[model samples]
Target: MTFTQLLRKENDDIFQAIFNHPFVDGIGKGNVPDKAIAHYIKADFEYLNAFMRIYGTAISKSAKREDIQFFNEQIRFVLNSEIHPHHNFCDHIGVGYEELQGYALPPTADHYMKHMMYHAHMGGLGETISALLPCPWTYWEIGQELMTKYEPSADHPFYQWISFYADESTGEITEEMRNRLDNIAEEASVEEQKHIKEAFRKSCQLELSFWEMAYTCEKWPGKEKVNS
Candidate 1:
């Protein structure tokens, strides 16, 4: 099979796993506690910002000028659409506009950010997408699961967020990404295939930790501050 096919298979596997997760139900129903959701949203944006800084620095230092410029533009587009608008999540959860940034995130939170930096430094944009795709795509796939397993409505936050990113409303997926996956597949050796498989698996495993960490911090006992 081609690399594109294999890449799709890998994404499918991860999405299926996430869709079946009990936590996914909370996401679908928008049943997640507001404080927890707020914290997660803030943490996610901070993480993305840090990731871009690392990636931008690394590429500028080593990549050809044109390639660096192109990747920077793509990353800018992603951040502008995905991260900035997502900040309004705090307001949805009853927090003040400035309060979200002051919230202290879990210490282990940087693992994903650092890993992304390392990957971008080593592998550039295509590899960067390989590492990044699991999160958004997983959610999109889980939305499908939620739709299949439960009734849908306009008020449901699950449908709101999922549809925002995955459906025609947002147009998150791009033809460039499709071509990149196809090219990677066409060029990959057996060893590279193994590496890609492992990277996808590792990325998923990290994703699980990411969710679990947020859950733990919010649910932790005897905490004086709830939102931070």
Candidate 2:
């Protein structure tokens, strides 16, 4: 199996919970609580900043021009166009965009972001991609599947979230990202391949925890790292 496929299959249960999580299902039905979803958007908004930095780390670590180009493309989208609407989503939830940056990092989020940065700093191109894959890839799959299965109403509260990831271009970008990871994986030794797969599985599990964290509306504990 390809590393992606292997990772997904090994963690099928987590993927199932994530894809079918109440937070996800709630989006389709517009049944999610305002405060809970708001907390999620805030956490995700904070997470994206770190995610963008990790992509930069990947670009610097990569020797391949195409890989660099791909990471750059993601970096541009995240900074320029990708997050504007999400900030608006935060506003709708009653948190100002600027205020979100000051909130303490929820435990799961801090742990997950640290996990990603470590791999980006310590791992090679393939390993960085493995560490990064589960978030976008899982969202891409869920976005496509949920919109189709549930066909959320036009006025669905989370319509934009459904529309963005479910869009055709999003799928193309996701496929391109996967191809880049696979290309790098082809150059790795067996031991390195094992490392890459482990990273993929760990990230996938983190993705599940992220969803759970959001669904439960876990607030920032008294002692934890602040979002940067």
Model 1, runs deviating above 4 Å: 10-13, 54-70, 83-88, 102-108, 124-126, 157-159, 169-175, 218-228
Best by TM-score: 2
**Per-prediction CA RMSD (Å):** 4.3, 2.6
lDDT of 1 by residue, 122-170 (tens): 6644566556555555555565567666666767655565555446433
TM-scores for all predictions: 0.74, 0.89
Using lDDT as the measure, which candidate wins? 2
Clashing pairs in 1: 3-185
- Scored by CA lDDT, what does every candidate get? 0.60, 0.79
